[model samples]
Target: MRNTISLRIADFLKSYPPFHLLEQEELKSIAEEITVQYNYKGEHLFKQEDPCKPYFYLIQQGAVEIYQNENGKEITLDQCDEGDLFGLRPLFAGKHYSISAKTLEESIFYLIPIQAFKPITVNNPKVSEYLLSSLASNTHTPYYTESPSRGNLDLTSDIHELQTVHYNKKLISCSKDTTIKDLAGLMNLHSVGSVVILEDGKPTGIVTDKDIRVKVASGNWDIQMPVKEIMNSPVICYPASLTASQAHLAMMKHRISHICITEDGTPNSNALGIVAEHDLIVSQGNNPYFLMKALLRAKKTKDLKKIRRNITALLEQYIKSNIPMTHISRVMFELNDATIKKCIALSIKKMNTPPPCKFAWMSLGSQGRKEQLLLTDQDNAIVFEDQDEASYPDIHTYFMELAKNVNKRLLKIGFDYCPADMMAGNPKWCLSLSQWKEQFSDWVKSPIDDHILLCQVFFDYDISYGELNLVNALADHIFKVTSDLPIFKANLARSALLNPSPMGFFRQFLLETNGEYKDFFDLKKRALIPITDAARVLILEHQVKNINNTFERYEKLAELEPQNRELYLSASYATKVLLKFRTRQGLMHGDSGRFIDLKSLSKEEKVKLKRCFNTIGDLQDLIKLRYKLVNLI
Candidate 1:
């Protein structure tokens, strides 16, 4: 019986929560029976211990604070804003309210009649389970204890339980008949300090660089002497996946610096790869310099692509090495950025001229922020100085052509083309400075749908190349126009808050229900972007300029907002962890770091993800409070 508006509410609600279990007709019926209530700022919807109303509430517009008395003090337990379902205790437990629900600002809420909804809860098993789980979570018992059967039992194991030692997979070997010069050439080519002498795919002996130095150069053996002459026999071998402790014991037992990884755990089983003690130590330590250098020297897109494979190798090494996540992220980001920059430089060289009249290419979204470790779609723009109207077409043509080449090159470099086509190649994005100023001004002043769309992309402008001054000028214009536009800030804040929390009311992971990523969690959109966008808006509101790095911006914001420092710091840590998780997932899957298979993650990873979600929940509450964006949508 509900009209389009109520049906839309029903449609939205059915995408989440207990409502999601309802049939379309049932949802529409519930939607029709619901009463829409609007409250002004600081208004109370219900007070603690008040008699239960006939209905539970869902935030249709603004935020509602759920406050509970803990010990002697009233503390804010949680905040329920748009699309958030609240006040379900009455329906579930038939009890008076244990918490007070109040409007943080002007708010609209849909009150669903418990009498009508109760029957569906009893009829739908999924609905019943969802409500029970939701109530369990809100009741504040330890999450794992609520369902002992489903608890993460694996967490009982110590961190050491997950420690795994990886060895090199490729083994360098040469036949005994090979000349010493050819053997040395092979060793130099593979950058290995030693080579195994194999007779018919079986390791017969090994010759190290030391043997070459002491035996050959010292005149004990000739340079032309066969590797078999200087080779050390009785080589040791071990199975792959040896633990660090076991590897140490094996090395001690054998008194050898290198262990040959072979089939069936013996030297006889054909060498797979050499695991030198030095290589093990290096793998255990944080050394990104080699990878960074590789990134810098990468000439072709294919070379960068190859280096990207090493990034995963390096990441696996780092995780095993126990490098701090922050250090890992910093180094990985530097390498990723360097690759992009090299790609840009190469793309520019392909251009006909050195960009007409000085322009800066800016990367937007995650890349602009330099938090992108896993390859994502490129979101970029081109900003040049305002040229005379007569010269505009020519300048625009040049930049557009350059952008086309750059975008194409980036696609080849592994950054998928933006689906919305929001790239420098787009005329809307490839703009001159004065034009950009006008564009941003319009977005700030009017903020129509298109302008809002543009703001989301353009707001995170980071200078990738060309004149820094031109980019700064654009930033100045944005601040100048937006300083007084509270509405614009609110809009951006609302956009940041658009993604529902990564967790459901039952505190289960929210998975993509549709698209190619169905059943997978969208860490990028649901988690990373929310934090990144929130940081950008807050930084812009503080008039902080040119700081596009999301985590750094949050760190800066923490200093600026003392009262919210802890929340911001937690946000920063969460961002880093989530970025690492996404990077690892992407590296494993060989795709953009977006959809993560929740089932594939270990228990520890799931727990870490949930912890990050807690931070996101807290940050979303803060955004809702600070921006007063509750009623905007």
Candidate 2:
């Protein structure tokens, strides 16, 4: 007979994962064994290295925090709320706890015993898998924290590489004798990209949309010809047990978009299904392929705006899944790049004439660094090749009109206008190659506060569209001018120290005292800028050009300065943590995520954020001493 408390617990358990996978009888049986416990805010459920309690916890009422002690300081790992599970690590490892769990608010918990749950995990694969996913999600940090090659951030260890891909079981096929026109009809009717050519149940060859478009639509071949005329013979085939990585490799090797799956892993065997590049992308869950395709097909600014929103959605998903920031940033960067390119393409069509001369569209600031994960203000410039002075006016006027159209369209596409008039449409930013080189040289020679700030923004520029040589020329000019100037480097490093420490005298976050964000921590100014500024100065000192991403800069700095590798690597990890934190905050509140409210954060969250500050403080000290900024400033 079930007691009222046990019944109520079972009802609650049914609503969440792993528990929902169990039968009603099984859920009740497990709930019968759960021991109810209560704790006040700040009470430890279990401490680091504590013996494994017989029961792990399920939060029933309030919040809990999982944290670990590193070098005598507590670093929060994750926070849990109602319906979340904690204390499961030791149950799997059969060792003392690696971290501590504590209540963040006065809370009630259903402490599910290990014995009651262990059998369920063994009997139910779905339950075990769900629990393991939960464990994997919460246990690991976003970027690797303790690997020796930590600077490199190995992205090759993708889980999708090992996971089996599900292919299209409904194979669309045509006989070798079928007319190309009928084959096209078959593919159009089925809404499939490729059609397998089969004879006697065995695979023969394949015809794809590309084949039809290139061969028939291009007027190179008649549609009345048999498919055998255009079919890619000896179809590249894989076994039904093909993984996404394997499929991707095969696609790349053969330079084909589709692969035939067969009963055996060869073309000689009976065909089973088809795996296209599209299938592999869809299987990955967050589809960059679809987004890129949408960008290419986008005809108007509104279409591009909708696609940019999708990119944000993808970013939010990536953050929630704990995808490595290195991977997430690269994906977002590419998508962002594609959107900018598409915008330029659409804008050029609006013009009555083509570009007067070859020009490079430079995306500056966070967009330039490829660190932008959310919609932000436009920061862009234009660098066209130098032309004869007599023709320069016409060229400049033409490009200015082009820049205005692009900026206005970008504004329409959700990238807000630059508040400081820093975009390409501004007459000051749109310039010839020689003019940009002169401008950069002047900034480096001057090195005042404002000039240094402009240098910081412009130096991270990457070519979004146009001639690469012009952008490369500007970069070469920057490195050449700043190469012999020690004082310029010193001033640049001094600028890194301009922001006060993220932590105040009491070691609390230095919150903004007066502004729209009063009492909110200035995350960008206090933390991100310091690290970015330091990286730029250090990388420039090394004369390493083109590597603009902040974390990548730190990684490069680590490699270049072996003596300071650990510190540089720590700075890289801290950049990831801060960016991830900011991205989360932005997604949660639908804002820029620059100003974080102290009151809204859990104690554990505050601790996690504080961990990054140590790295920033150490980095600034290094800059101050190395650059002799102490004496100069």
Candidate 3:
């Protein structure tokens, strides 16, 4: 007969794997021998090389992170949540534990004794095979696959951006004729922050808690007024079938907190439910929303710097959870953009007077392309409105002071100064619109090998602040000059192919011959830069502007050239793989992930990294042939 505790344990065990394959009586019998334990957050369950415990663990609640110490740094191998089984590999192998497991939160675990579980595995071939396969693959469960060499687990697919979002089916709504007081009451009754305004069974407008607080309470308006007066009309609506990424984009693009879900995703259709930014934040467990809020509220540069640490932590969590790189890149880019905007805002306050004229702050290189993830050197420039020679000196002087203050804030916030002095604070980079145009025209019309490097850096500019028209005009000037110039494109292609192939004759990584990083594989120079350079030249030739990201450029290229769609798509995938690889290496080593130590890589990892080299070689060949750079090289 089963006791209450054993019955409770069996009930929970029946839902997870292995035990899910067992007969009820057998599972209950095994559960009777189970011992339950409790742990607090940050507590360690086991350490690397410790003798294997007599049992394996199943998380009943909370989370555990499995990690290993490498060069005195803890590298996270896997994270286990409720209903996940761990510590089974050591038990099966009869060897010491190779990694340490610790609680990420206060946790409750059910320890299944090996003595009791061994007999069941022998009788159930399915259970034994599952365990053996999971152990051999270095995976904690069948749901995730782990790489034996890097210990990184693949938990998500690349197309997670297309996953349908979960919206609130229990939508709180009111009639447009309802008074503000009643609408507030309706929202309070349902414990919701928003109420959709419906007219004739369709959403006509939406009123949120902010509307009430900002208009009625702050403006001291009559509470008896109809909601139509304060409610925002033509409510943003999307189909109930909207994906998570789509929902996020809609909310961001509209600058709204809530989105109305309708039958047809248009305001004309009947409302099905509502999706809140908060709901998506909770669903995805990525907290860019809160981080943005903190950034907006921050008063000092130190506060912004502190928030950047949280951003890094959030980025690490996203990578570990296997969030889609596209979504990750977008979130990080927005946060970085916001940080810079806030810095400029604070810097303006330090000035005795406002700007002399319209200007635009430009972020260059990787940041301009929206592909930056790690805290790297800052690359920025300034472009103000074109001015006559009379007032040009004064306008330039005022903006220069402002740019210097902004640059100092960024450095304090952890972005290192560019070793080559490529920041806006430099007089050479901070220029009037005409000077920038002439500078670009000079580089494009006269394409020197050395000048191509500067062109590459300046071409991918994104406006961080000030006037957009200024930057747009600059972009227009670039296309105008480069559209008819094939020589420049050829030189750019030659630059892309300057680095030797990433792989040597014997399938070894091409190591740097000499430098501070001697014998280390330059992932950036050999792999990333080639792909980026090719993308830039190809996009320029096609007259495609605003698509600066290398992978995105390849994806766009795939659409434009149907005959070579396969090659372009392969380049896109390879770009993402290499970016993620570099990010992981940076996070582990606490430095730029450009230089890779070949000795540290597992054979499996080496093989995976090498797989990307084939696409690189093919891309270089295509660039050489398409640009007629064979003779030039």
Of 1 and 2, which scores higher on TM-score?
2
Decoy 2 TM-score against native: 0.66
- Residues 1-633 of candidate 2 have per-residue lDDT tens digits of 649999999999986666888999999999999999999988998898888888778888766767678888555555566666777765576568878888766899998988888999999976775566555544323222232232543333344455578988899997999999999999999999999999987889899999999999999999899999999989999898787778888888989999989998888888889998977876664456667778889998998888887778878877875666777787788888898998899889888988878999999999899898888899999999999989999999988888998899888878899999999999999999999989999999999999988998998988999999999999899989999999889888888888857887889788889978898898999999998998898899888878999998988887789899667867887798789899999999999898998899876467667767888988988888898766643
Steric clash pairs (candidate 1): 62-630
lDDT tens per residue, model 1, 378-404? 898898888999999999999899888
Give each model's clash number: 1, 0, 2
> What TM-scores do the predictions have?
0.56, 0.66, 0.59
436, model 3: CA deviation in Å?
0.6
Report the C-alpha lDDT of model 3 over 400-471, residue by residue, as the tens digit. Answer: 999999999999999999999999999999999999999999998889976899999998889999999999
Which of the numbered candidates is closest to the native, going by highest TM-score?
2
Give me the overall lDDT of model 3: 0.82
Candidate order by decreasing TM-score: 2, 3, 1
lDDT of 1 at 196: 87
Clashing residue pairs in candidate 3 (N, C-alpha, C atoms within 3 angstroms):
238-265, 239-265
Worst 10 residues of 1 by lDDT: 140-149
Stretches of model 3 off by over 4 angstroms after superposition: 1-286, 631-633
